[model samples]
Target: INDTFGYQNYFGIIPIFDKENLLGTLVIELKSQQNDYNSRFPELLIEGKLKSDEDFRDYSFAFYKDNKLYSQSGKFTYPMVNTNEFEGVSNNVVFTSEDTNNVSYSHAIRKYDNSKLIVITKEKMPYVVRLATLSFFFLVFILFGIVIYILLWIAKNLADSNAGWFNINRYLMINANKILYKTRIQFSVVLSVVATLLIVGWTTFSYIKEEYLKQQKDSIREKIRKVQLSYEKQILNLGLRVDDTGELQFNQFADVNAAYLNLYDINGKLLLTSLRKMYDYGILEKRMGPVAFINLSKLQRSEFLNPSEKIGTFTYAAAYAPIRNAQNQTVAYIGLPYYANEADYEAKIGLFINTLINIYALVFVLIGVLAVFLANQITSPLTFIQENIKRTKLGQKNQPIVWHRQDEIGLLIKEYNKMIAALEVSATKLARSERESAWREMAKQVAHEIKNPLTPLK
Candidate 1:
């Protein structure tokens, strides 16, 4: 009997006494269902009973009864016996026989099952899952290191620039204060406070943004993982099979779909691809050479391991993961494109920075305006006082200071007027006394002249 369905159930066997004496014989009983009995029993019955020509011609088939061969084929054209008598026979028995032409033939005493063939193939090709995992992690570490190094370098450069600007501004402020003869200490203090606040605010904002980006990266990675996992599960569950030529192809299931699957060799040659050819084919192919392929592999492997590993700018969070082969090698990469929602946030930050700059500029402008106003207020009165003193020195005290307000300048002008008044009174008194003395001297001179004249007459 042929086990066409691969279910081990033994049917009645055919016994061949000779090449021409083929006869249906007793029912075959399997010793144990645990063994694959259907695989070997029919061949043994066909070849063993037909081994001798004389027995084949007579064609006497028997069931072994009580450890004795009992002829049952003599009375009936087809022999029939108890199914229990053949129980002790193992399923593995084989027989060799000759045909009418004395040609020997052998058939394999085994059951044919497609499932067994599939099992054998699966066993022969093992997937190295652990090695693939390790390789992915290693690439992830490398990519993460590169990102960290770039961030640190940027931060260092910014710090250096800020320090240089601070030093230059400080020096300029000192020199400007000296030339203007103005105390800029209060302005410097205010600027220092503003700078410190701005620095702190920027640093805090950066740190917060970095954390948010990290979280978003993790979320995107989780989404990709979920999508891939669902796709893989669907593929396995649906018993999908691909074409044999190792073509990179995608199968769409009831709820899952994948696209752009590609395969590359170790030398970075494109073996098979299912990518869309919408872009510039020549330029893309030329630019996607071995180096680009390797870099993409690394990035993909990193993303596969950490999934959160991001690529492209933070403003648009795009990332990739590796497609690994059974040999634990990165064969290809899969990428998910996403637009980060940070545009508004970035714009806000930019606006904030601009606002700060504007505030600083306004503060500087205000300081300059205040300095000029105060200087004018103080110097205008001093200039008026100085001009009045110059008039007094020139003996032109005709013009008096017109005091408009009762401030310090008004009081100075009042004291100056009182001094000028006292000087004028003293000058009048001295001039009168000098005139009297001159008149007395003149009178005495006249008397002397007269007396000289009288002496001449005597």
Candidate 2:
């Protein structure tokens, strides 16, 4: 019916019945003037809902009718969906892409005819959005660090209190100050190194990505020139004009290269493309992009490099150039597209980060050991002096600290020794005064006794 009418159409049949008495059948026919049923099928299945849904913008849909991959909204969506994978599935299927990080969730509905209508949703996470997500995780890590610091602070306070746990925590919090100096040094060293590494790694990753894209653009321009020259040579040898060129030779060249090629006529109508799958899946339009057309045709430029060419949620660098005849007249335009593989780029970044973490781990261990050693060296002398001061007593010869070096600690020891010497002299004077007072008391007692006896005799 579609071939006869020159339009694609779908039909629905309903049996007419009156109170359980079957009658005739009712038929409904819908025709599509666009004549693109394959392209329109997925759109109709979605009911234009994805466009209005902000949350589903990063998602692309694919439909499988009767376990066959029928249509997809994006070229890269549902790459793992195949007839073989659905053979034994008695329920919904879940799959993920092998080439990328896209995951597909499948919902299968059994039809009346025993066939299945499978709706698959694939997440299309772009690299830019991934970076934003990484930033969020980085912020969470920082918050976690702050929480750890606060907990340590509270523990330090508890160590100083007269609580039952004080003895157990006291050894851990050896520093006398409010903040543990040793812990502060360790945290500072680690945090500083981590922050520095993060900043440098982020900047370097950006620079490397930019430079790699620049190189890809340059390579694309070169490929376009090389292919253009090869095409012109082939046409000249065959004595054919631009209108007479076929896609066979063009496709052969495209198969030999890494980048996809697009050929457009003088009026900007697409002639052929190396990537037919993109067009078949409705991922690309069959005409030159408007910006590239104007820049190449109207501006009369030999070449133009579009650094931010977009396809679905993917961005690539596209290079365009004009194909000219021997008479210097523009015959057609050529385009080459180069996609940036974020997975590979991120893998490289991960490897670099892992290496940095390993190295910093070693550095942290060394710093910790050095900090402990330095803290012990600083606190050992103060501990000794503290024990001596506790033992110091009046009326007894107190031991003086004998420090050899004339540093800060030596000065402290000198003052402490002087206090001990003065204490000993004061003790001697106190003992002699007590003895003299005792003698005076004895003399008074004797004189009183004698006076009392004489009074009694009288």
TM-score top scorer: 2
Runs of candidate 1 with Cα error greater than 4 angstroms are 1-283, 286-301, 304-319, 323-331, 336-375, 383-451, 454-458
TM-score of 2: 0.53
Q: Considering every candidate listed, which one attains the maximal lDDT?
A: 2
How many times do residue backbones clash in model 2?
0
Please state the error at residue 298 of candidate 1 in Å.
6.6
lDDT tens readout by residue for model 1, 1-458: 34322234556665756667756566675533321222222122234534443233223233333333332333222214433322332334333222323322321222122111100000111133334444445545766999999778556655884555566568668977676323343445456656776687688768866776677667767766665455444335542233543333342321133323333344455444343241224312412233334556544435532222222233334444444544545544444434333543565566556554545444544554566676666667877788877777432345567898998888988988888887777777877899999999999999999777865566
Provide the global lDDT of candidate 2 against the true structure: 0.66
Clashing residue pairs in candidate 1 (N, C-alpha, C atoms within 3 angstroms): 17-50, 300-322
The TM-scores of all predictions, comma-separated, are 0.30, 0.53
The clash count for each model shown is 2, 0
- Which lDDT tens digits does candidate 2 get at residues 1-458? 53322236788999999989989899999876432323222222344644354344335555455556556553344544455543334454545333344543433332222344444444444564455456545655767999999789777767775654656567456744577555666566667766776787678768876776566567667877887787667656663333435666667667665456888888888887766666777887888888999999999888888877777666666778888777877888888865543433455666656555554454544555676676667778888898999999998889899899999999999999999999998899999999999999999999999777865567
Clashes of 1: 2
Assess each prediction's global lDDT (C-alpha) against the native.
0.47, 0.66
